[model samples]
Target: MIFRHTRLIMGTALLAVALPAVPAMAQDADEARIKKLEAEVRALQRKVFPGGDGRYFEPQIDSSAPVTTTSSSPASTTAVTDILARLDALEASLQRLTGQVEVNSNAVRDLESRLAALESGAAPAVAADNLLPDEQPLPAAAGPAPTPPPAPAASGPSAQRLAAVQAIAKPQTDDPGDDEYSYGFRLWNAGFYPEAQQQLAMFVEKYPRHPRATYGRNLLGRAYLDDGKPREAAPWFLKNYQEDRNAERAPDSLLYLAESMIALGDTNRACIALAEFGETYPAIAAGRLSNQYEANRKKVTCN
Candidate 1:
């Protein structure tokens, strides 16, 4: 009877162990089936959506079948994480593309605006005539005016007699004689700017026949410039250049003329002046004005 009891106990223990192993084997088989289904789903996704990174996974179970909570939860969480990551990556790519497009759009707009501005003819003015026709001509004296005769000799060397002798002995200065050429220099030295201007203008008008008149005109323009009036100086500079292109002061006057035109925003005229300067006086221009000529040449824009 004891042997029969021992056999029954051993059999019960063996059955308990065997029953636990049965569920384990079934679980392992189910896991392998799940792996196979996953591989098939991956292949189908690759075939349906070629070259696409998006993926989908589904278990092969009847609609009415009960799903184990623990098995489904991990897979569902993994799929959700993968989808969220893919969505974030897609959004990042879209943002980068959008930024690039915006940059290109702004560059195109800037170029279009530049083209429009160029087409609109917003350039320097070309006046009807550079010089005003109605402006005052330089002053000129009618040929030598009649001179008054010397008064009768005074009796003695009184103040009036001395003054009369002194006046008579003083050489005639009204004439544009050799002394007149130095009039501008004297006035400048004496700090008489107004008188210097008048004398220089008179020299330009009356002594235009003189060889030094061209120099005087240049000085007159410089005088106006020293007085802080480039507009007023430009005409005299132009006249000096017109009167004597080969004068010693001609190139200087032309240079000043270009400067005046630049001040007046007359870039076209400045360009012309620069070109003329380069062509007319090559030696002096090459030495002194190369940079200015190049700058003005660059500033010129033609339609």
Candidate 2:
């Protein structure tokens, strides 16, 4: 009976040892399988998101959520920042250019206004001879009155002498210094534009260096402007202004230049001319010319 009890105890001890080893083996196998599954998941993550850290088993965040930053290289980040800064600077530069353009535009508009005023407000030129005729003084009475002569008979020679005296007293048309220009000016004032143009052109050719040359040129331009032929008028105005910028008709010429430019759809040159007029003749700003400039500037929408 003792032998039988010993055999049973031995068998029980062996069985306990064997059972513990089986559990240990099972745990080792489970660890190997878990490691293999982790490796496979990492490979899948690499395939799905090539540059991402392979933490596939981790809980995922919502893709639609906003991200504050990305895992980008520092150099790349810096380059992106520099690009943004450059864009900002470029935008600022563009804004400055736009502001400068606006300033220039305003300056041009102001200049145009002044030019229009000067041109529109110029007074017509009057010839020096056209002023009041010379007044004749009455003959002074002698200290004692002379005795009156007997009345002469109305005979043939006496009548002929009287006729000659009457003819001499009649107003003469042949004033050497004042015929051509005066006639042209009269025609212009009377709205005989075609005849006036012809007369004025002839006068300009005949008396190119006369004191009234500037006035004649300006009047010729005016005739074209008034006749609605601004293209033809512009050259005359420009000529007058160029010939004698300080002459009485010079401002008139510049004014007409702007007007003709506007009429011809050459607003850019017209604006430039207008601006120059203001700069050249700052003194005209407070005169009637300024008023005329303002009116024309508004018409062109200069700014």
Candidate 3:
């Protein structure tokens, strides 16, 4: 199903792209290509709305196959763009449905654990859901009175370590924002997830126009993920990917988005992200991001 959405979008995008640059070709070849696209669209509709009336929806590709199209035909291109937008909406709906499924699955698991505990005469499963990766702990102040006290504050060298790393690194470039971002990077690299998140978040918010802002945003997501909080991480990665698909760190954001989704038990969405990364950034996927993407794809076992 995910692949179907990807193929439909990419295929239609290809049409919008190929239409403008099509070489002078035999009329029949253009017709054949349009025919293939039309067929794929129909197949997609049937798969998407199985056992439903086919007449309710149809691909809007004109059969004439204007071979000399330029970028000027905004009216004609709008329909194709709209089709792609609707496909994206459908994909979003599917992801929401998957999230609901995950919630339901977790509920069932909690119930099963409770029943097992009863059978064995063990402690109640009150905190079974806490064991779930996607379950976020309440804020310390918001937690129940019975909740365990927050961990003792860092002390001695630990306090020194935290305060010491909070200072920004020396400026490597003219941009002080770059140094601020490096501070977050150093924190993350040193395994200070919470501090890294705070630092990166401030850096991103304060210097939204900085060259390293994209890097800052992506690193913020990494901090959350490293802190075992994928729910916190996924949105930042997604925002970076959606906001600036061509940014230097955008590919990393997309890949990390997949990893976070997988961690959160939403392999359906993770698979979609993985497929998008492969489709939209094939070169990067085959180059620097290849290993991580491959490992993540294996985690989801994407079809």
Candidate 4:
């Protein structure tokens, strides 16, 4: 009976040790699996949110204590539920912020387009429905009018001449300010030199800082030259060239100025002007000026 009692006690002690060891082995296995799952989750997060700089939420588990098969206490379950609820709220807040960022980005692009148009002296594009019936533009004339003969040279600008130069009325449009310049350019091309000069003068007065201001000034000089007033044209050409040498019309103004100087019996200055034109716009094609540069060069006999 004593031997049987001793055997039973030894068996009980061995069972106690074996039970604790099994739990410890299970805890170690669970920890290894959790670590492997965490690594995979981190890799997925890196791909899903490359801009997040590895930031993410991970639930904390106590590694110091061994896990068991026992059911969780009520307090622990409640805490886990609260944590899940907070994570859901955080996800919703992030979505709202992302939406707001997209909206702001669109607003910024719209503002930039408007600012660029304003700087370029171009009116913003209006929807067709927003325009009034009267705001509709009339069809441009099929052909330009015949050019009149050049006026006679005068010792000075007369009162009648000045009045004629300022007589053309500006037309009204939905974007009247912008269209006024176009109207002047069309009138000039249509051979209405006096009216063109007047309209261009008005444009310069109104939109002094406009992007097309250089074009208006250059065309005004051409009007004076075509009207047989070389003396009057020279100053306008000089002004256009001096104001903005890089303007698209600047080289043309210089070329015309050289022609005007020749007409005014200043061949030395004309030759100098032609030299400057060649130096400033070396790559400019002859087609751009309708071969006027070559013709002028022949007239002055430049070397």
- Which regions of candidate 1 fall more than 4 Å away from where they truly are? 1-178, 189-192, 288-303
**Is candidate 2 or 3 superior in lDDT?**
3
Backbone clashes under 3 angstroms, per model? 0, 3, 0, 0
* Error of model 4, residue 78, in angstroms: 85
The candidates, ranked best first by lDDT, are 3, 4, 2, 1
Choose 1 or 2, whichever is better by lDDT.
2
Please say which candidate is ahead in TM-score: 2 or 3.
Answer: 3
Of the candidates numbered 2 and 4, which has the greater lDDT value?
4
Model 1, 182-233: lDDT tens per residue? Answer: 6675664554454557667766667777867777777777776676656567
Score residue 68 of candidate 4 by CA lDDT.
Answer: 38
RMSD of each: 25.2, 26.1, 26.5, 22.1
lDDT string, candidate 4, 156-222, tens digits = 5688866654564556777665677887887787667776777777876687678888888788878
- lDDT against the true structure, per candidate, is 0.60, 0.63, 0.69, 0.64
| TM-score of structure candidate 4 | 0.43
Single out the weakest 10-residue window by summed lDDT for candidate 1. Answer: 139-148
Give TM-scores for every candidate, taking all chains together and pairing residue i with residue i: 0.39, 0.43, 0.48, 0.43
- Residue-level error in angstroms, candidate 2, position 159: 38
**Residue range 209-228, candidate 3, lDDT tens digits:** 88898898888888888888
Error of 4 at 105 (Å): 50
| Best of the candidates, lDDT | 3
